[model samples]
Target: MDASELLEVLSPEGLRLLDSLPPWRASDDVVSSVAALRRQGHPPERVSAVLTQARLRARAEAKFGEFASRMLFTEAGLEQATRLNVAARHADRYRSAGLTSVADLGCGIGGDALAFAALDLDVLAVDRDEVTAAIASYNLSPWPSSRVRQGDAETADLTDVQGVFLDPARRTSGHSATKRIADPADWSPSLEVAFGYAERLPTGVKLGPGVDRDLLPRDAECQWISVDRDVVEAGVWFGPLARAGVGRSALVISASGAAELTAPADSEDVEVGDLGEWIYEPDGAVIRARLIGDLARSIDARTISRDIAWLSSDERVETPFAQGFRVLETLPLDERTLKRELRSRGIGRLEIKKRGVDVDPATFRKRLSLQGSGSATLVLTRVAGRHTALLCERA
Candidate 1:
């Protein structure tokens, strides 16, 4: 939102109007809602501002859950905000460490700050964007111990806080249509300055999961987290916040709860072996943390190929860290032969999984000209050292 829209939305009328609107749905008529409000003599600008928030609140529900109803957000802020469940985990780090205060540098709409304050810790939430800081102050207003201010995160006074959480801006400054900042140096507060905070204070830095591993500090513990199978963020912890004897970790969180695989360092890849009765696909977080070897050992599995993340074992082993599939048969990698084989089995519905292959699944599937009602998963990958296709079923 721009300055004028922000001002309009912060008014009493705006809050009341936003709360009064029915819960937004994809099927709702947005144009009609705006027209109805405008007809009621609400100014066009106020109507637009309130409706925008209403839509944002709907989208925010996936991240903030019910708390999103009362919170304010900008498009960019909502996009980058941490999921409430994940933020609670972050807050637990400080609370578990016996730290009673934290400085959330570059806090975006106070997503993490909300968690910290909810845990009854004092919070200093700082943001360089004035509008975002104002929105954050509003979101964090319910917590008496939480303070929000507009300032440079790098220059923010840290004299009173016991721990620090930094989420540097990895995108250009804007409420919308912002481009990603590729260089860590171009990020707001920069990685160097963000990491430097660990020299004195217990610190946790949230970064994109795809960040270069070489840039990580040797003294810190790096943990990659995946929620519902989607790898979300990589958190680097320092000092007491860093877990003992854990250097690299993969944390997977889903409706089933959380599971973690950790090692003192990246585990050596297990030796490649011939295809087994079961094929397992390790979670993205596991692959990103380079703990695939550890996961394989846990399940008594081995890599299908030297560099491939896919694993296989003759015994059926189940683990949250990976999805196991029972091998159905081996099929020729040639397109025409595979098409004939699939059609013979009446396999019309297919789930295509690929690794260490160049063919696009979507394009390849169309070329097969599938028919019939049966369904199966087609895994196109390297077996031993050669490209192969494995027809499989979820185990």
Candidate 2:
């Protein structure tokens, strides 16, 4: 639709007409209302558009839950994504980290903007679309100095902004799945451009959780964040470059219940090993930080290698840095013996985890007739060049 027509449809009177109806549903009532509106001569396209808009509002309302005030909503201050909580939590971190003001690049529907505003930070929320910008402004109206601007970040003025937040549009061609950063280098204004910008200020870039770590800049602080045990988004933190003595690692988790791991700063002299009496699986964030050595020391566990994420210890300790499982017995890679021994021990269902082995856990389980009564996590891994399995239980 043209801008004028779209604006007319979203005009004050139009919004009222849309809002006066009960919230949307797919049931008979909603269907009847749409049918009746059409029967009254409302164009089918307009009716369909209004229904879509109404349903979007209802969905946002549900997503914001009881904390709707913390979100940036549309003209009626409703409509939300279920991921708002995660955004809000990160916003808190931004504030606590001393970022007084922020520029939210690509502020989709303003989910993160609402969180930034909720923390009372001065925000310049920007989007390329006028409709979205208007919606953001309306959603952020409650906070002072929180304004939504329609623009592109590629050439926007950085001025004195202390931190910049970038959520590159992962989808292109009208929300179709596409490369998050078409030019991996230009991934969003190009990583080189982004790092240059970061040199001027602390920059936070949101990337897909599955992004390869090897592709990131050596100097950036990489973090993989998982909320409630489900990995959500991986981020890169870059500011002034640190001195050479400091290590390069990814943070796999947060202090407040996140799982992460780190790659070794120096890759040449690392070691690898099999599962032991105690198995420590680092958090996703920590693994990303490449700070596994720090974690290993903190937990008094030994690293199998700089690249491998698992930690081994004779003592099972409860630490957020890693998920510790008590090892029951160590066996060989022989499936027949492994299966028979597990079955004799009354093993019913098995949760298998493997590293550096080509064995398929599922096919292996079926081959051994592994279906009956017990629950356990079996580690099929190699340590010090030997294929061994460790049966474990949660510590």
Candidate 3:
């Protein structure tokens, strides 16, 4: 939204309307609500702005939790902002490193800046977009340690700051339509420039988890982060922020809490062996960090195939880093043979899971016809470089 529209929304009457609204649910009738508001003599602009804010707040709940109600967001800015829980962890690094002040370059909608300021660190939150910067200023107004400015991050004077945190814009500009910029060189304040900041001060930069591994800096501590089962971001920490001796790490955050697997150096390859009684699917963060071998060793398991990531062992093993499944039986890879075997076993419901293969699970599921009451999981993968299927249940 434009500055004027945001101003109207931030006015006293607009805030009251936004505050009075109930938790929006799918059952709410939007057309009727707008009609009711119009009948009450509310201007269309204020109603439009209030409705937009309410909708954005509902969506933002997944990232900011309860704080979303009081925050302002642009469509693109909210999408690009880091989750508040993750931002708090990032803030801890600054506090732990003895860094008292930080330059939050490219700080969009003040997500990280809010966390940093909450920790009592001096934060200079910078964003080039005027509306976003203004919103960030509003969000951070409660903290005396926080400041927001509208300026190019690349040219921002940061001589007084002890460290820098840059979350580069990785997409095309706009609230309605944004194109993902695939090339790291195309990111605002390009990787080449951001990578150089570590030479002068401690630095941390966030990138897409699938960012080219070849582009990672050797001197930084690169970490892949996963929230629940979804891999969300990859970050590189330089200088003291880089955990000592650790070159790569996988950090998993779930409802239970957080767990990490770290490697002082690149993981070594483990020998492949035949499937035993159990199969282990390592977390995505572990796989992205290239630390699957470490996870395999910890579980006393061997790779199911040289080219595949699935690990196998003789007993049930459940660890924080991977999901364990008990092997019920092995199945034929052939479609007709598989159908016959499944039908004989009275399996009607199936959960198809595949790795290291091109077959689409949903498409294959549609082809199966059976009459049974049992539910089963089918693992489609390579074994000894040969295609195979294994039927199993959760361990």
Candidate 4:
């Protein structure tokens, strides 16, 4: 949103209207809602701003929880902002390292800055966008230890700052709707410059999970983070914030809690064995961090293929790093044989999983003419360099 729209939303009249409105639901009637707000004598700008905040608040709750309600957000800022819970963990590194103040360059909406301040650390939160920096100032108003600025991150003077948190804008340059900028160098402030900062001072750089491993600095601690099974962010830590002797780390965060694994480097030298009684699908974070071998060793499992990430073991493995499923039996990969086998076994519902070999599950499912009452999990992958299918159940 523009500065004018934001100013109106933060106004007393606008806030009262926003607070008075009922909670926003995804299925709410948009036309009726707008009509009702107009009937209350609110101007179109104020009404629109208030309604937008209300709707954004609902969506932001997933990331910021209750704090989202009190915070103002621009659409792009909210979309790009690090989840508050994840930001807290990032803040802890600075606190634990005895760093007193941090400069969060490119701090969209102050998500990480808020966490830092909450943990009793000082913050210099800066953003290049005018309205975003303003919103960040508003969000961080409760903390006297924090300051917000509108400026280019590369030009920020952090001489007095103890630590640095750089989240270069990965979207196209603008205060408007964002589109992903594909080139890593095209990222605002540049990844090259970010790594330069890493080499010079205590720093953390946030990047996409798919960033080329070869591009990662050799000395920094690269971390892959996954929330609810989806790989979300990869952060590289430098200086004291960097974990000792750890070159790579995977952090999995879910409602259950957070679990982490660290190693000096990624490797997949473990033996690939024949398919066993149970199958384990490693979490995306684990795979991305190249810790599947580590996880396999932890669970006493072996890989189904040297190149594949899937793990298998005869005994049950109850680790958060991977999902374990018990195999029922092997199935034919061929269409005619698979269809005949499914019909004979009376399996109507199927959960299809695939890896290594790329036979479309949807098309394969459609071709399977079934006449059965039982439900089954079908795994399609390569075993001993041959296309193989295994029917399994959740362990």
Clashing pairs in 3: none
lDDT of 3 by residue, 206-289 (tens): 998999999998888999999998999999999988889899999999999999999986798689987899999999999999
Which residue pairs in candidate 1 have backbone atoms (N, alpha carbon, C) closer than 3 angstroms, thus clashing? none
Candidate that would win on TM-score: 1
Residue 120 displacement (Å), model 3: 0.8
What lDDT is obtained when candidate 4 is compared to the true structure?
Answer: 0.89
* Candidate 3 ranges beyond 4 A from true positions: 370-372
**In model 4, which runs have C-alpha deviations exceeding 4 angstroms?**
174-177, 343-348, 369-374
Rank by TM-score, highest first: 1, 3, 4, 2
TM-score of each: 0.98, 0.72, 0.96, 0.95
Cα RMSD (angstroms) for every candidate in the order listed: 1.1, 5.5, 1.5, 1.8
- Runs with alpha carbons beyond 4 Å of true place in candidate 1: none
Number of the candidate with higher lDDT, 2 or 3: 3
Model 2, span 143-164: residue lDDT tens: 8778888888677766756678
Candidate 1 deviation (Cα RMSD): 1.1
Residue 226 of model 1 has an lDDT of 98
Candidate 1 structure quality by residue, lDDT tens digits, 1-395: 88899999999898888889998898999889988999999999999999999999999999999999999999999999999999999999999999999999999999999999999999999999999999999999999999998999988999999999999999999988889999999999899999999998999999999999999998999999999999999999999999999999999999999999999999989989878999999999999999999999888889999899999999899799999999999976889988999999999999999999999999999998999999999999989878999999888
Candidate 2 lDDT? 0.66
**Candidate 1 — what's its lDDT?**
0.94
